[model samples]
Target: MASKKKRVKLKSLSQGRPPTLKPLHSLSSKATRTLISSHHTLQKLRAKAVAEGDEAKADAIAKEIEERGGIEKYQHASLLGQSSDRGGDSSRILMDWLVPIVPALKQHASDGRQMRMLEIGALSTTNACSNSRLFEMERIDLNSQAAGIKQQDFMTRPLPNDTKDKFDIISLSLVLNYVPDAIGRGEMLLRTLEFLKIPHHLDSGCQEIFPSLYLVLPAPCITNSRYLDESKLEMIMDSLGYIMVKKKLSNKLVYYLWRRVSFSTKRTCFKKVEIRSGKDRNNFSIVLK
Candidate 1:
């Protein structure tokens, strides 16, 4: 009789051995984007597998992630892209837009209190807005890389109770795309409102400055997604009472400044129905529940 085949068991994501991290340096722009995008895709697949209770598939994905050098390596690659030599700081463009449109940000506020900014998913303390004297910034990230950045999940942060706890502006650069699912992305967007200062009456330019969101996303999310486009994004923001103040689209990224126009309680249901169809379009979407 043939010997019985030995069974092979796989470890779950938590039980899997940690990946061997290698030092990442000088990652080209294309390579950095590829790594980030690949990680996102794998994460989405793993989320689906876990949700469907496919233990074996989840474990396989976990192994694949390990082989790819895990989250630490992915983050290191991202840091390379953000280096000054790459001109990868999204806030530089944000500063350019603000100086001409909202001159108040170029100088200290009249009350002697600098504008408060909450930078979610902050990777560096040396970025344009962080270095500027115009804003007192509180930077938070899921994985803090340095001393000043607090390691915190934005989703779990406590809601601001009073005006002092709120912020004048919130930056979510390249963050929404990192959310593993569509509904979570929408929730993150809604949560930004809870931490923002109340819409105060002021000059048009100044009003546009405070209680705003400086959003940066990969250009393909808007241009190549089957369920999202510029119009769709605008509609979603409008439902949340935010009006677009400025928008700039580049080859690889898209930037938007949205100011809260009103505290509208009206809700809009945006499902993940495909709004556009084309060959090679991505499935990126935001679902408002």
Candidate 2:
């Protein structure tokens, strides 16, 4: 009668581990209670819909997750959790981090396909390039939801083998600000260009021609501006062997079209060239030749 005894498995708490069991507290604040209630309600509804095979309701909930800024907010929360103090301006933060590394990207670009392009942090660059007849566009982003985007961590992951020598233009539009590390952001650009040249044969095949680059940053002269300083940015590009082919400002945005001067051929002349002569002689040249 007094025969059987059952064994219960217990979890171990080691020297470094915190205790697993604790008394539950009713100390949750109003916001915590509301969040718990909402989460439970959502779980119940989702479970009901799934059980009934209500595809439409499930789809609506999915859309609501996106429309309510859930994804962006989640990404932000993750960044904050990692101890980043960059604050709300993710785009500007990424730009500041990336501006210093533009030169390396210009040097390593490869030309195997009709155009080799690597768009950094851009979902809109592809849309913009759709309007341009000159260059084929390739959109690259860390965000998985970006349309036609290749999902890869530009900072850590190597570029895909298939993308080598596949692009002609590399555009980084409002991307660098989101990354917390400045060097990693720069390295991402370099890695992207390196990835683009990997598939091509070096000599007889295509020499992996460096592609032209377009960098858009925030303007410095304007107060509370998120844009990069044009003069300083051009200096950085110049050091990297990229010459400023075009400069334009729209609202808070500053765009610079740069091409590697060493790669310049007679066939690829700039649309506008500025020439300054000696004393009492300053001229603006519009390149027609």
lDDT score at residue 71, model 1, on the 0-100 scale: 69
RMSD of each: 5.7, 20.6
lDDT of each prediction vs. the true structure?
Answer: 0.79, 0.40
State the TM-score for model 2. 0.42
What TM-score does model 1 achieve against the real structure?
0.87
What is the C-alpha local distance difference test score of candidate 1?
0.79
Per-residue lDDT tens digits for candidate 2, residues 132-167, read: 323345555555445666765555444465654445
lDDT for residue 138 in candidate 1, whole number 0-100: 96
User: What are the runs in model 1 whose C-alpha is more than 4 Å off?
Assistant: 1-23, 101-103, 106-110
Look at candidate 1 and tell me the lDDT of residue 140: 92
Model 1, span 91-150: residue lDDT tens = 988888777644565544656656899999888899889776678889997767778899
